[model samples]
Each structure stands twice: as structure tokens, then as C-alpha cells.
Target: MTHLHRAFLFLGTFSSLVLSAAVSHGQSCANSDQVPLTKVKLEEIASAVGIGTNDVELRFEDFALETVRPGLPIPHNNRFFFSADRRAKAGIANVVPDGVIPLITITAIPLKTFIHSNSVFYESKAVRRTRLPPSYQKYQILGFLDALEHSPAGSEGSFVPAIVFMTTSDVKAISKKTRLLATVQGVGILHTIACEIPDVLPTENNLQMGAAIVVNPEVYILNISFPFPSPPGSPGRVRP
Candidate 1:
């Protein structure tokens, strides 16, 4: 099948999963619409995803260059709020507790950075309400190398790797400290995080937030020195 066909199939499957989840949860089957997700619930969900409450925050806006750049034009919609290192210190945290906050801890690469890194992973499968079998022994992790070898051009890029936690019986038996593994075909295995939170949470255009990869920036040395001016009328322009 063509890459376009695969994408369609992939999206269709995920759509079905979301719809099924909404119906199963009695969220909004009457209008064929899903229920809205809440911030408190998102925190619970993120926590269940194996990250601490302080480690993950829900983001509702597109990332801007200002995050990595300064003195740039910042387009604040006033609709989305973000809380983080400098943002929180700037009183951005007074807006809402669940507004976009840091999803990882200090010293860990930011979620945006991870999304743009080469160490990211992803899962293409739709999660169900059923429990993952204790005897289940297969992997479903998709990584960068696998994308290079398998994903179609223009589509092989970084994405937030999401793993769904089942809210059924099997999860209850697993300890919160225990980490499960799910492998992707031809790829590596991802640590499966089990949360009791349901999938009925609100989503933007039906797109639920996925799991995130953690990365660290490279260590580099900075040599700071002012350049000496050349003789008068030098070919190079000098800073005033």
C-alpha cells in the first residue's frame, strides 16, 4: 500500500479507538461527540503515565521560537497559559494550575526539545480499555531509526511518543513502581506506564496527548572573548 494509504489507515484506527472509548465511557454518544477533558484529570492521567505530578503539564498551544530564542515577537493568544522555569517566575503560574507547565524536571530536556530530538519514540497502536495480559510478551515501540527505514518521506520526523494506559483489571494487579515493556515490530520496546485514568478526557480535535521522551542537551564549552579591531578602514566591520 502507498504511504498515503498507510497514513489513512493509521489515522482511521486511532479515530475508531477514540470513538469507542467515548462510547464505552458514555461520554457523548448521543451527539456522537466525546466529552471534554479537564486539567485536573490530565494531571491524574499524566501521573499515571509514569511521570510525577510536577514532571508533566498539559500544553494547548503551538511551540514558539521564543522558547529557545529571546527578544523575538511573542504571540500571546491569552487563551493558553504556560508555566515553567522563567514563565512561572514571571507570574504566569497565577493564571491556572493546569495551564501549560513543565512536563519534565529541571536538568531534563524540555518536552519541546525532546520532540525535536533524534531519541524520540512513538506508538501507532490504539489503546483499548482491556487489560494488557500479564503473559503478554510483545513489543510495540517505534523509534527514530525505525522511522528512517519505514516511515514515508515528509512524515519521518519527531513526534510525542504516546502510550495508553488501560483502566481495566490487569492494571490493578501491577504495582505502581513496576514498569512494563511493549515492543514495536522491527523497533525497540517501550516502557509501558499503566494509569487508572480513562481515555474519555477532553482532546483538541480528538487528538489525545501521548507519552513523551526525555533527552539531555549536549555539554559544550563556551569561549567568550571580544574581537580586537583591525587597523583603520579594515575590510571587516567593527561593532560600535
Candidate 2:
């Protein structure tokens, strides 16, 4: 029962706990084939959890248990863009326009939801912040192509408006400095599209920015193909 021996015992126990927790997290997130979140689920979670509302507080102390269930359907009408391998590449082809793409292997407690832990404890007014969790604070990872300088056909704009949950890690991992002629599958043909760095929009916070793209007025996207790297035989297109 020496003091040094006791200290060593405590450290060993702590390390064991940490390692176990990490392994459990990895197992949950490894289910990459989990069902994508759908518009219905998005609305359900938003309503159940009060996402996009003034009440920007954690509904529970532990997000891992109370957070929206992992593997919920990702919302529809979201598309991801990537840097083109060829400068002359004009469009992405042969994609399931009405299909869903699972970009992130979502876990019960997203890394951001845990890392941005202040939101769980502080009031929005107290922190002088606006956007709330389950939506703004906790977002799915998305691929953003930094190269495309697309704007409204006649007007040159730097950013476009998009709707989805994106993480900072996703942004850093996918954004390539090269640009390309981006496009989405239209009703009868592939319509040219442009990807832009989103600027701040007038949300409740008025300081939130996102990754977005431009589309032709005639073309409405029913679904999008997010080009995140996936394991072989996984659903959704992995190539542009």
C-alpha cells in the first residue's frame, strides 16, 4: 500500500476507462450503412428536441444518451460537391437523383456536440450566441469544393445558400483548392451548377455561415450525391 503504488493503480484504472469508452464509440460509428436521415426524421427530431427554436439548451445533461438517435435519415435535397480532377470537367453524371447519401458515420454523441460543450451548460443570451444545437451546433459532415467560382449566371457572387448540417472537420477534410464546372442531375439532363463558400445569412444568430452552391431556377434538386469517400459497395456515388 505505498503512495506510488496507489497512484499507479489509479492511472491504470483511468486509462482502462478511457480506452473502453473510445472502443465503444468506434463501434457505434462504424455502422456506416446506417439509414440516412430523411426530411420526416429531421422535422421529428427538430420538433422533439426543439431544434431551430429559441430554446437553445441541451434537453439532457448527457448528450450521448439523449441526443437524437444515431443513424436517423439524413435530410433529402442536400448535395455535396468536390474539386474536379480535370479543369474541363463540367458535370457529375449517372447519379441517383432521388437517392440519399450518407456522408458521415454519425455516432450517438457527435464529436462537435461534445467538444462544443459550453452550449450544454450555458444560456444563449448569457453566452451572446444565437444558433442552437440539434441543428446549428451539431451538423453532419459535408464535402465542399473550394475551387468552383460560381455565381448567379449574370451576377458574380462568392457564396450560395444551402441547408444541411456540416461539421468543421468535414469542411477541412474535403475542401480542395481547385475548381470545376459542377452540375446536378436535372429532370431530363444534367444541369450545370456552381459551388460557393457560403456567407453569413440572417438566421436568429445572424452570424452563421455554410457551404452552398448555385442551381438553375428551372432545376430543383430532389436529392443529391455527396461525394465523400465510402467503403466499396456502400450506397451512393463516391466519385464525381
lDDT of 1 by residue, 8-113 (tens): 8866665555434322432111122322234344444445445455443212221111121123322332332222322323423212111111111122234232
| Model 2 C-alpha lDDT per residue in residues 115-151, reported as the tens digit of each score | 1110111001111132222112121111121122221
If candidate 2 were superposed on the true structure by all CA atoms, what would the RMSD be? 21.5
Q: Report the number of the highest-TM-score candidate.
A: 2
Return the lDDT, model 2, position 240: 7
Model 1 CA deviation exceeding 4 Å by range: 1-117, 129-137, 141-240
Task: Show model 2 residue runs off by greater than 4 Å.
Answer: 27-240
Candidate with the greatest lDDT versus the true structure: 1
